[model samples]
Target: MDYFLQLVLNGLFVGAFYALVALGYTMVYGIIKLLNFAHGDIYMVGGFVGFTMLTAASGAMGAKGGLLLLIVVMVLAMLTTGTLGLIIERIAYRPLRGAPRLSILITAVGASFALEYGIALAYGPNPRAYPVGMGTGSFNVFGVRISTGQLVMVVIAVILMIALDTLVRRTRSGRAMRAISQDPRACLLMGVNVDSVIARTFFLGSALAGAAGVMAGAYYGKIDFLMGFIIGLKAFTAAVIGGIGNIRGAVLGAIVLGLLESFGTAWLGSQWRDVFAFGFLILFLTVRPTGLLGERVTERV
Candidate 1:
C-alpha cells in the first residue's frame, strides 16, 4: 500500500511537468493548427537560462537565498522564453500561415534544430549541473513519503495551471482565443486581432514550459541541450490523449500519462518506460484518436 501511494505521489509530480509542457502543445495547436515542434526547445532554453542566472548569482547570495533566487530566476527565464516564442512565431510560422501545412511543419522542425544547436553552441554539448535545488527534506503522509522539492514543484505547477485555466475561461482575451480557434477568418471579419491573440497564446504556453524547465533543473540537479526532445514527444502524446485543443484535456492526459509511466517503470523496468508510453499512444490513436476528452469535428468538404 505504501509503495502504491508512493508511486501515485511520484506520478503526480511527473504529471505536473507534463501538464505544463502539454498545455503549450495544446494551445498552439488549438490556435494556429500548427504543431510548434520548437516548443520543447524553448523548454530547454528555459533550463539553460535558469542555470546561467543561478550560476552567476549563487556566490553572491550563497545558500541563504536559494528560494528567493529561484523565484527570481524562474521569472526571468519565463520572460526570456516567452519573448523567444513570440519571435519564433513571428519569424518562422507567420510567413507560412498561408503556405502548405507541410511547409509549416518543416519550418517547425528546422526551428527546433536551430534552437537546439544554438543552445549547444552557446553552452557547449556537456550537461550543466544546476547550482540550486529544493532541499532534501521530506515528510510522510498516510504512509507516503513526499520530498519538499516534489511538493514545491507540484504546488507551483497546480498554481500555474489554475491561473491559466482562469485566464482561458474568464478573460476577454481567452474568449478571443476560443474565437480564433473556432474560426480565424470569422474572427478577422469580426474585428479581432487574431495575430495578437495567437502571439499571446504562444507567449503563455512558452512561459509555462519555461517554468517547468526551471523546476526540472532544480529538482533533477542536471540539464542538457537535448533534454527536451523526448519530453516534447511525451507532452505531445499527453496533449493528444487529453484532446489536443482542450485545455482541461491536456492536464488530464498528462496526469494519466504520468501515472502510466510511474507504474510501468516499476513493473517493467525503466528501459521500457518510453515503449509503454508510445505504445499507449499507438493504442489510443488506433482505438480513439480523438482522445479521452477530444470532440469529433467534421470538416466541411
Candidate 2:
C-alpha cells in the first residue's frame, strides 16, 4: 500500500507537468482546430530560457535566492516563448489559414524542425544540466515520502491551471475565444477581431507550455532541444483522451495518463512506460472517438 501511494504521488507530480503542456495543446485546438505540432518546441525553448536565466542569475544571487530567482526566470521564459508563439502564428499559420489543413500541418512540422535545429545550432545538440537544484528535503505522509521541490512544483501547476480556467470562463477575451470557436464568421459579424483573438490564444497557450518547460527542467535537472517531441506527443494524447477541445478535459486526461504511466512503470518496469501510454491512446481512440467530454459535431456539406 505504501509503494502504491508513492507511485500515486509520483504520478501526480508528473501529471501536473503533462497537464500544463496539454493545456497549451488543447487551447490552440479549441480556438482554431489546428494541431500546433510546433507547440512542443516552444516548451523546449522555455526550458532553455529558464536554464540560461538561472545560470546567469546564479553568479549574482547564489543559492540563498534560488526560489526568488526561479520565479523571475519562469516569468521571463513565458514572455519570450509567448512572443515566439505569436510570431509563428503570424508568419507560418496566419498566411495559411484559408489553405488546406494538410498544408498548415506540414507548415507546423516545418516550424517544429526549425525550432529544434535552431536551438541545437545555437546551444549545440547536447543536453545541458539545469544549474538550479532542489535540495534533498522531504517529509513522509502515511509512509509515502514527498520532496519539498515536488510539492512546490505541483502547487504552481495547480495555481496556473486554476487561473487559466478562470480566465477562459469569466473574461471577455475568453468569451470572444468561445464565440470564434463556435463560428468565426458570426464572431466577425458581431464586431470581434478574429485575428487578434486567435493571436492572443496562441500567445497564452504557448506561454503556459513555456512555464511547464521551466518547471520540468527544475524537477528533472537536465534539458535538451528534442525533449519536447515525445512529451508533445503524450500531451496531444492527453488532449485527445479528454476531448481535444475541452480545457478541463485536457487536465483530466493528463492526470489519468500520468497515473497510468506511473502504475505501468511500477508493474512492468520503466522500459515499457511509453508503450503503455500509447496503448491506452489506441484503446481510447478505438472505443470512444469523441473522448470523454468531446461532443460530435456534424460538418455541413
Candidate 3:
C-alpha cells in the first residue's frame, strides 16, 4: 500500500508537468489546428533560463536562498519563454497560416530541430546540472513520505493550472480564444482581434510550459538541450488522449497518461515506460478517436 501510494504521488507530479506542457499543445491545436512541435523546446529554454538565473543568484545570495531564487527565476523564465513563443508565432507560424498543412508541419519540424541544435551549440552537447540542490527533506502523511521538492512542485503546478483554467473560462481573452478556435473567419468578421487572441494563447501556453520546465529541473536536478524532445511527444500524446482541442481534456489526458506510465514502469521496469505510453495512445486512437471529452463535430458550414 505504501508502494502504491508512492507511485500515485509520483504519477501526480509527473502528470502535472505533462499537463502544463500539454496545455500548449492543445491550445495551439485548438486555435490554429497546427501542432507546434517546437513548443517543447520552449520548455527547454525555460529550464536553461532558470538554471542561469539560479546560478547567478547563488553567487549573491548563497545556497540558503534556493526557494526565493526559484520563485524569481521561474517568473523570469516564463516571461522569456512567453516572448519567444510570441516571436516564433510571428516569424514561423503566422506566415504559413494559409499555406498547406504539410508545409506548416514541416516548418514546425524545422523549428524544433533549429531550437534543439541551437541550444546544443550554445550550451554544449552535454547535460547541464541544475545548480541548486533540491532534495532537502521529506514529510510523512498517513505513513507515506513525500519529498519537499515534489510537494512544492505539485502545489505550484496545481495553482498555475487552476489559474489558467479560470483565465480561459472566465476572462474576455479566453472568450476570444474560444471564438477564434471555433471560427477564426467568423471571429475576424465579428470585430475580434483574432491575431492578438492567438498570440495571447501562445504566450499563456508557453509560459506554463516554461514553468513546468523550471520545476522539472528543480525536481530532477539535471537538464539538457534535447530534454524537451521526448517529453514533447509525451505531452502531445496526452493532449490527444484528452482530446487535442479541449483544454480540460488535455489536463485529464495528461494525468491519465502519467498514471499509466508510473504504474507500468513500476511493474515492467523504467525502460518499458515509453512502450506502455505509446501502446495506450494506439489503443485510444483505435478505440475512441474523439477521446474522453472530445465532442464529434462536422466542419463549419
Top candidate on TM-score is: 1
lDDT tens digits by residue: candidate 2, 99-179: 998999899999999999999999999999998865458999999999988988888899989999999999999999988
Clash pairs, candidate 1, are none
lDDT of 1 by residue, 1-301 (tens): 9999899988888988899999999999999889889988899999999999898888776653467789899989999999999999999999888899899999999999999999999999999999999888999899899999999889989999999999999999999998999989999998999999999999999999999899989999999999989889999999989988999999999999999999999999999999999998998888888899999968877
How much is the lDDT of residue 142 in candidate 3?
76
| Per-residue C-alpha lDDT of model 3 across residues 1-301, encoded as one tens digit per residue | 9999888888887898899999999999999999899999989988988888888888777654567678888999999999989999999998888899999999999999998899899889899889875567999997788889988888888898899899999998988898898889999888998888999999998899999889888889899999999889999999989998999999999999999999999999999999999998899889886788898856656
Q: Of models 1 and 3, which has the larger lDDT?
A: 1
Ordered from best to worst lDDT, the candidate numbers read 1, 2, 3
Alpha-carbon local distance difference test for all models:
0.92, 0.91, 0.90
Best by lDDT: 1
lDDT of 3 at 169: 92
How displaced is residue 200 in candidate 1, in Å?
0.4
lDDT of 2 at 296: 85
Instruction: Name the candidate, 1 or 3, with the larger TM-score value.
Output: 1
Residue 6 Cα positional deviation in candidate 2, in Å, after optimal superposition: 1.4
Pick the winner on lDDT between candidates 2 and 3: 2
TM-score of 3: 0.97
Off by over 4 Å in 1: 62-64
